[model samples]
Target chain A: DQQVKQNSPSLSVQEGRISILNCDYTNSMFDYFLWYKKYPAEGPTFLISISSIKDKNEDGRFTVFLNKSAKHLSLHIVPSQPGDSAVYFCAAIMTGGSEKLVFGKGTKLTVNP
Target chain B: GAGVSQSPRYKVAKRGQDVALRCDPISGHVSLFWYQQALGQGPEFLTYFQNEAQLDKSGLPSDRFFAERPEGSVSTLKIQRTQQEDSAVYLCASSLGQGGWGLRTEAFFGQGTRLTVV
Candidate 1:
């Protein structure tokens, strides 16, 4: 069963615009959420994350907002750049369990210059 | 040495063949995990190791799949009697702690080994 889901398969946006990627999860036990960006033939790199205690976390141009009541989260990138084009995956894990991260199908984001 | 390293970036094997994939995690990392990624799908966890002790391996698909970490440094994923459905990208990741310190140390991933069984 897919516990974490990214409904959008792909997204396109112009450069210098704000890009928003959404993710939803059904597992209420998940306490930590992370976003990863992957390029062709490369491993997925950690972008940002948020915990159940906090509703939001920001790093540089990336910001992750979590809504526990709705079981939804979003990754917002300001001034999207062409280099940011890649497959973005959202993952969740229970902090106390095995810590095995459950990942979404991923969303491909393209930034047109 | 500096990052998680997975060898044999690409591998092609015939049906019924056995293949072993290797992973070398960063020095001093205490947690190691293996994941399998299929085409157009996200990565799914396969197994996990903590200092040579395999704490979790519930995600292993079947009995033909086996993994080992002899010295707590390097790991190997062995698939016996490989099948076409076994083809996918196998990834290895490592973290500094065992999630005990409450530090959200992100796991670093290797490029991954793409396995194709024909």
Candidate 2:
């Protein structure tokens, strides 16, 4: 079973617009969450992450928000740029013990100029 | 600093052939992990190792899957008598701490070794 899920398969937006990617999980054991951006033929690059202690975390243009009760999290990018076009993956990590991260199916985002 | 690197970027093998995939983690990193990603799907955990000790291997699909990191710097994942279902992108990631520090440290992923079992 897929513990983490990204309902949207793809998204498209214009430059200077907003791009919102969402993720949800069924496992309450997950306490930390992360977002990664991946380009074709390349490995995933870490974008942002948040611990359960906080509801939101921001890194410049990337902001990640989490709702513990809802078991959901989202990544918001304001003023999106063409360079932002890529696949975004949401990962939920169960901290301590094994720290095995479960990832969502990923959303392919396209930013057009 | 150099990031995680995986070898045999692309490997094509017959259904019954055995295959080995390699991963070289970042220097001084204490944790290593392997994951498998099927086409159009997210990555699934395969195993985890802290130093030379394997902390978890519950995610491995079957007994044919074997992983080793004898020296603690590099790792190898070997699949014996592979089948068509074994075809997937095998990903390796590493972190500074034994377990992912989450907010403080993020696991760095390699480009991955794409194995195609005919």
Candidate 3:
């Protein structure tokens, strides 16, 4: 069973607009959520993360919102640039229980110029 | 190296052959993890190490897979009698602390080695 799910396989947004990608999880034990951005032929890089204790965390143009009660989270990129186009993966981990991370299938975001 | 490094960026092994993949973590990082990623899928955990001791390996697919980090800074994942299903990208990541809590310190990943078993 997949503990993490990114139902949307792909999303498209125009440059200078806001792009939102959503993810859901079934495991309640997950306390930390992270977003990683990956380009073709490279390893995934950490973008932003949110601890379950917080509802939102932002870094420059990237912001991650966590809704623990709903077991859902979303990543928002404001003024999306063409360079932001890539695959975004949502990952979850139990803070002190397990060292491994469970990742979603990923959502390919295309920012059109 | 300034970042995590993996060798043999690409490898093609015949079925029943054995292959070994290597990883070099950051100079002072204390945690190392290995994950396998199939096409169109996210990375799955394979094993984890704290210093030179392996703490978790429940994610390894089978007995053919084995990993060791004798020096704590370098690790090797070896697969024996490879099968077609063994084909996937192997990624190695390292963090500056220990255990699950250490991951909060930001795990840096290597480029990953793509293995194709024919």
Task: Report DockQ per prediction, comma-separated.
Answer: 0.65, 0.77, 0.67
Worst 10 residues of 3 chain B by lDDT: B97-106
lDDT of 2 by residue, B1-118 (tens): 4899999999999988989999999999989999999999888999999999998999999999999999998999999999999999999999987676465566789999999988
Ranking of predictions according to DockQ: 2, 3, 1
TM-score of each prediction: 0.97, 0.97, 0.97
lDDT of each: 0.93, 0.91, 0.93
lDDT of 1 at A24: 98
Q: Count the backbone clashes (under 3 Å) in each candidate.
A: 0, 0, 0
lDDT of 3: 0.93
Deviation of model 1 at A39, angstroms: 0.6
Best of the candidates, DockQ: 2
